[model samples]
Target: MRIPVPHWPSVAGRARADAGPLLLAAVVVAVVTLLAGAVPPLVSATADAAVRDAVRGSGADLQVHARMEADDGPGGSRARHPRLAEDVDDFRTRATDELGPGLRAVLRPPVATVISPTLKITDGSVLRTFQLAYLARDGGPAVSWIAGGPPEPTASETAQVPYGAPPWPVQVGLSEADAAALQLRPGARIPLADDQGNVKKAQVSGIFRPQDSADPAWRLVPALLSPVAGADGTGGTRFAGLLSRESLPDARLAFGQDELRRTVRFTPEPARLTWDAVPSVIAKVVALKAASGSSGARDGSLKWETGLDGVLRNVSAQVGAAFAQASVLLLTLLAVAVLVLLLAADLLVRRRAGALAAARQRGMSLPVIGGELLLESAVMALLATAAGLGLALAVAPGVSWQWTAPVVVTAVAAGPAFGTLTAARATRDRRVPANRSARRWLRNTARLRRAAVEAGVLLAATGAAVALYQRGVGGGVLPASAPALCAIAGALLLARALPVGTRLVLRRLLRSRRPLAVFGAARAAAASARVLPLLVLVTAAALASYALTLGAALGHATALGHATALGHATALGHATALGHATALGHATALGHATVDSPLASGLLRLTWVAAVTLPVLGLLGLALGTAAGAPERWQTLTRLRTLGLRPREARWVAAGELLPPVALAAVGGPLLGVLLARLTFGSLALPLLTGADFTPAPPWWALGLVAAVLLAAVAVVVPVESALRRRRRLSEVLRAGDT
Candidate 1:
């Protein structure tokens, strides 16, 4: 003791003392980081599901078709032989080369096809015109013989069949259904002629059926499977008469090379598509189109056609809308996260205010104190953020820097900023209370600053609204931040109204004879300066309500799509060709809020988490905000108790203090939610997610449920907080140097 040992704080002691605030900060940073990190992957999954759905629905239109008229040699020299196989392979090679690797990966091998000009077969008085179709066996669907076997090639060596008098007919096959519709069976022979007077005697060699009609092999030439109604005013059904691969040479001899149309088709494999690949695939398709056009113009023969570009463009638009919709939920989460983080920071600072002030009195510089706090916050926040991002990557597998970085930075910085401000304010508490005039001047200055902030928020909200409205009306895309901006503006407005409403209650209570009512009202009026809790509660309430509304809308839209799909299936008599019903059934089985396939499950999960988190965050924020001043409140209650205030009167005081914010949020939240929904739904394109449109109105029951839940939470949390304050004994309050 005589050696004068300096009393330095131990690291373990500081860690123990700072544990509560550090844990709180860690949790906030972790949760916000996790949610932000999950967004990119979840949004990507939902958009990918939409893309797959669009591609699935496009059917044959989703494939690329290159069609060209088979040219006959000049002057009918007939010396040069056409190599159909070599020509097809060359076409396939060119197409794949033009499409690029990204697009080529998702496409099936090209299907080469040849079609003869329209030829009529008269069965009694009714005529059925059909095209003699030949598909390469290697790339087409597997077919089963329903009656006869495959057709045989003609035994002619010359092009034009030598104009023989008794030549064998070209052997052709037809689908069983088409054959029945045409009134032709195996061995039936019919003389068919085109408009150019070119004639061919076709003998029915077999009736075959596709093993899987839904196979992509049947997509390009649907007439090969079913009879299509002719639009040539002949009132005849059109059919694609199937010809064996060996019949190509005879077909050219019978129909002439110029009379045939040759095509190469590439069907898209929907399973291989992803949201990230859409733009690249579209670009490749565009390049392919340009290449084909230039080549076609040069040769005056080859041309490529496809609707894949249009389909991909639609999917890209849908992805944009989906991300915009997701932004509303994520931004709401972030806004509330920031608010709760600040409230938590304020609580941490309040707990350290005495020590910080003592340190200031010991001649510590403000910069030094701020730097220390920043380092402490940075260390804890960085650890939590790393863990959270790691967990997010493990769960969803993608990092969204724009969303995650801001949340992490804000969560880390909030604590140090609040601590520095609190330290500065606490050090000045040594001065005597300001006189009335000085207090008035200070209050006026604070009011002016608040007014400026609120005016700026209002201006921002207005600009966002105008931009969103213009975008929605003109392009059907709402600006992503519009809903969040409006929510903040609405919350600020409600915060202003809170004080006036409490003052009105105070006046009414003063008029009453009951002393407890007056006391509770006066307490509520004094607490009006605490606007953070009110803003958090209102904004959170609005977000919860808005999320519920969107959920219900999505559910309704999904159900409507399911119903529509079922209706189509019923109308079509369960035709496999109409696959939308099956797709919607799959979506319905997953849940009522998502689209087809398991990829869309992330959307439902994310929305549900947001819906649950927003309300809980509000409740936590309100509790933390109230708890920040718990010591002062308890001290005041202790003094009142000494003056004969009853326990019932104390409870009333606590309830009154909480009632304005609770009631304001309960009433204003649903209204703000409805306003935000109205503003967002115009460009949200909810139908893109579920394939059905719904009314924009918030369901009455859902609104009531959200309001009731918020009230219930506040009712429970406020009383619990009040009871916690009461747990501190009178001796403890006095030991804390309460006067």
Candidate 2:
């Protein structure tokens, strides 16, 4: 019977009761889902600020805080690499500090610390020793300390002389950062005195506290804060974090972005005068050093690493680019996941055609029917988007959201478009002629068959990679699930080479006696069986290329560190006194001792700067913006089946949805957008670069996985719900049997 259709109000009450709650729930879900991506920008900004702040000294460019090595090995030989620039005679000229570009910033970090003991009773033995010290007394604010109370005026004056020459020349006190690092709870004494023999003991009265701004740092007087001599200047022993700023006037003008100012007392005059006005500064410096005799040579190889400012820009860019590349990939994947879920939603609308048909019989027009059907789609899409946004903001504070008019418009527009498509398909499918039902059934069956075939291919490819991994053919590069495309092609050529094993299992599991459960199982099996080939192909091995490439790169970095260590050891008879050792040396360094060293053996290594190293962690976090919605849908379905406990549901959601929703799309995206704006849009320019273009593939791969995991759940959950209500529909479709 062609049933009479009614208007919106006629069936509005019934429709609201059935689909209203679910649709509302969908909106909530979308809101929260989208919200997950909201806060990433803010966090990134904070982190970036902290990192830039922490990169305090210009020397951070080439500085390794400390290094140790064994010297005078068997026959005075040192492990060194020939290819390295350690002992190269030509490098001496090339490494000259005459580069005009390097004339900008000069931030001398803490020279090192000194420790003096007036009294010490270890193992029931008392020892008194003057300590060797570095020039840390009254140093400028390089580091800050957090302390309460105060420090002692006088130390016990018992110090163990670990390595100090008599008459120690100059020594600096420990920095607040350094003091904490050593766990020398306040009251530790620094060895003070030019005389290494009678090195006076200085107590750790207090650490220097530095404010973020230079204004505060300059105004801060460590000695005044913790006066060593006290107000009356009669204290026996006292300590203070001193900053030597005699060079401040000089430093003020000399300190540029990545350069330091050095007071070179001599620059030799050209012996033969040529009107070429630009004096060979390096040649002059070398000549001056030669004339300064042993005094200048003692300083040795002063390579003025000017032009640090330019390097800083490049380095920061390189780092930001690498990480941002990964971020872009994640974002793309996430966007894709949403689209897929939308696709699945369209599919579900088709599946639920009978429900609409039943509604039509109760007097509903096509438009009214759409209002009924679209209630769910509108709800889910909005909810997922909202949830994603919420998750993003909550996790990553300071996320700058660009509520672009277009994006908002598109999202809003997608709502009704999604509804219209589902509504139209469902309404049209309901009225399909009876002659086409056979065709529809055949198509579904064919789709399932195709899915099964794909699963078989994946399984075969995985097996091959597994075999290769066992034989150590690939260097764990394919450890995840690398594909030898050639082998896969070969497997494909073998006509009967499908994964029959999975089909058998599916057949067994779907053989249930119960109706709904059996039907669900059958439907899932057909759905999943076809998906097996794709799943098999998505094995960890498929991700082997990423691990392999990154692993090799990291290995190269490790090798560089080794090479650096080797170079240092070969230069000095022993590994030179490193920054760590400087604290123990008090007095003057002796006269110039030049021993031409040979490159005895090769030690492969490389040196690394540590200042901007931690930024990688943030990038690691922000690379999860894309994921599969199906994973989420499936999980939610499973959770619902498991009694739909709130905690369990949340847990599943977090594990499945939080990565892409919170980190990538919301957090990272916001960070990227905000960072660009915060710093004059410098951050945004990089986005349109080659670095961004690199990580696109892997990002897409993972992003898809993440989006699929989440979006699929939404589609699957609704489909499964509708499926449960399918008993009557199934009966109606069944052929009538006669006795």
Candidate 3:
């Protein structure tokens, strides 16, 4: 005979009746998947942007220009020497070859020339001049000019002034001030001399003036040549002239070796490279220098200066470490979601246990019953997965295909699998004996199984802790996973201690003369079935407390580091002390922490957001779990009311039972969390938090806040139970038969 499969119509009808709990389970799954899909990319983009801003602001990617120094002899005497054109070219070529495609263009502006000139003006009065090179490469002389811009060079005129070699007969450019002082114009020939008194003739090819006297390029202009007699017969300094790069060779030849060596300053215009490519460029340069040393080749002292390598490494490490934390948090949320769903499934199964047992008695096979349950679970999972994906897309659009596919698969599979397993476990064919004592049931082997499971969890958590400690929080799952595992282990240990502690408290309450206390204690002592739910509730609250405390502590540390960094910046004159001081003072007054730099601010924000979000998620999970247990609470309250227990006494009984676990979690979770946070803080590569002198401390206020929130949540259970009691009729509740 073919076994008749359960029809879909019956399953659909049952699911419709149970829509409230099913919808809640679906929402929890949706939320967990949404976070899993969204956090990684958001974190990566934020880190990259912060690092880029920090590197760019510090000018770390700009190439430095240094004078070549030579060790003269066996005694190791060193002297500064002019960098030859060939030497610069060779270094550029090595840098390009070593760095490969990542290397962008290299600029080598011609050496600077110092010239002192005595110009014979049209009026026959003498004018003194000081001149230095003005090149066309990074927005030239005209770019800096405010009035009377530099003469535009023709194609042929530009071709004449080749790079690295200056043109003869010296083409020079003059600032408008210098030209006005001498009554000179473009193409006007002027006589110039070095400090050693050697003279040469040069034509002014351009005339320009600086927008600001203190413009960096203007500072390159040599100081006024020796003073000249003014029209009033008193000596006055002449304005400096801006010469073309083509004037360098002619000036060098005219001035001769000694005076040119003493006075002229040659600085290559800096090359700008991308922020990401800086570390690679530095590495290549170092390798080339090492190779050159081994080969006994002539080496130029190329002094590379930057904190960029450290900054980049730290950025990458911090991002990795933070993502690890996010992963752990995501996993915790998922675990909680799964547990809540399973509990909902178990509750649903228990409510229909009589129907399930009756169906079994009528020759319904386990496969048929399991199939119906699985089908219902599958429907819920499919709907939940769809809702989750939609929510994820809405919140974090452009999620990578890798993250999206896995999240979808996990959500689809997880709900149905867990729900089916829970239903199967709750719907066993054997009947529970009506005469089983509460204490005997509480001390049963199934209770031993729970203890074993807790032990296994504690062992696993210990292993994870060892692995995390070995890994040292550099940039991976350990940073996040360590805390999560510790929280779990701590929660389990706390759960194990609750029954014994509650019995002792109940015994003490039984001796009281007060009827409320005696009744509440008796009720709490007999409520053996509430152990698991109470354990879950306490664990969730504890996890939330721990997360908040850790986050607040990290935020405070980040703020302190930033404040210290800002103070250092002000002391070093990098920023105005008055402005920063005022801002910092205001922030302090407003009870907001401030960071000095962009990188620190980004890190601080990440910690603060995680801290706030994780606890809220834990609370949400707790609320769903509570909602699932409402029916049982209502039935229990109905039975109590029938035994002459008042609604006020019922509320007191609920509070008495819940307060122990909530109080335990509140005290234990933070202490364990604080310890975990202290251990994990060293792993994050935050500049401010990692140093010999850096000591991280817990945010005590945050711990207190978490305790208050948890206690309030526990307190809410009483009112909720009372509200649930008020809504149900005594007749209906009495007929409900111990649900």
Question: Stretches of candidate 1 above 4 Å error?
Answer: 1-15, 18-21, 60-82, 118-130, 137-156, 159-168, 173-199, 204-246, 287-300, 428-439, 472-478, 561-605, 687-694
In order, candidate lDDTs are 0.70, 0.32, 0.52
As a whole number from 0 to 100, the lDDT of residue 725 in candidate 2 is 32
Backbone clashes in model 3, listed as residue pairs: none
Please provide, for model 1 over 44-156, each residue's C-alpha lDDT reduced to its tens digit, 9 standing for 90 to 100. Answer: 87777777766665543323344443434445433123355456556656655666677779877667777777777544456567678877635557889989888776563
Question: Which candidate gets the maximum TM-score versus the true structure?
Answer: 1
Instruction: Give the C-alpha miss distance for residue 643 in model 3, angstroms.
Output: 3.3
**Can you give the lDDT of residue 57 in candidate 2?**
22
For each candidate, give its TM-score against the true structure.
0.83, 0.35, 0.71
Model 2, 477-538: lDDT tens per residue? 23212232322332233212223533454467557664334333333333332221221122
The segments of candidate 2 whose C-alpha lies over 4 angstroms from its true place after superposition are 1-39, 50-54, 57-307, 310-318, 325-340, 343-352, 358-397, 400-574, 577-739
Q: Give the Cα error of residue 58 in candidate 1, in Å.
A: 1.0
What is the lDDT for 641 in model 1?
Answer: 81
Worst-scoring 10-residue span by lDDT in model 2: 591-600
How well does candidate 2 score on lDDT at residue 435?
A: 73
